[model samples]
Target: MTRTILTEAGAQTAPSGDALWLSAADALRITGWELKPEGMCRGELCVPLPAGMAKDGQIDLAAFWGHIGAPLAHDAGGTVWSLGTAASERRQSLETLEAPDFTLPDLAGAAHSLSDLRGKKTLLVTWASW
Candidate 1:
């Protein structure tokens, strides 16, 4: 059986277990992290993984996710996981006091993005189902 891996970007199907054991390709597809001899790397950022973290040449998804300070949550069966942004990244975003850029249609059906008004005083009104 395979577990459903969910991230803000998208969802992926990965091997199921108490923890996910992923091949290098699967890791990249799901989390954009590459398991290398030196560490888990994404582009120029290389995070030195601890010894034995990649046993049998497979990356432990849960271990590496938590190791990088991201919060991971799964169901009782540990078959569905939701990976959140890393704490440091979240903190940095918060420090900026800026909402993430998004696009939406206006009354005239014109598409506009928050980023388009980066310098202007833009008021965003949002409502959600809680």
Candidate 2:
């Protein structure tokens, strides 16, 4: 059977016959990381998996995510699963409530610093013509 796995990035279909485990390939596609001999790897980042996270070559989705402190939820029927942002991301957001200061050019090429508007209530709108 297939289950719908939802993440902040988007959703994807994953093979989940038991609704609790996902094949290595399916899990990799859904999570953007692959379980390897070294660990779970994405690009150059590798997070070592705790022992027993992978069994019979299938990953216990819930346990794997939980091990990394990522939040996950599943529907009552287990047909849909949602993966929340990593705990580290959430912690970073909460730690810094203020937007980072940056400089950007205006229509006429005049640069403006976000810090300059710190004392005033400002509404900034940005658009891209693409």
Going through the candidates in the order shown, the clash numbers are: 0, 0
Top model number, TM-score:
1
- lDDT per residue for candidate 1 within 3-114, as digits (tens), equals 9999976688987555677777788988888888889999998999887678776888788888898999988877888998887898898899878876777889998878
Candidate 1: the clashing residue pairs are none
> TM-scores, in order shown?
0.75, 0.65
lDDT per model vs. reference: 0.83, 0.82
Which candidate wins on lDDT? 1
Please write out the lDDT profile of model 2 over residues 1-130, one tens digit for every residue. Answer: 6789998657888765786588888888888778899888878978888877887878887887887788999999998999987879777987897775678777899988999998898787777889
**Residue 83 in model 1: shift from native, Å?**
0.9
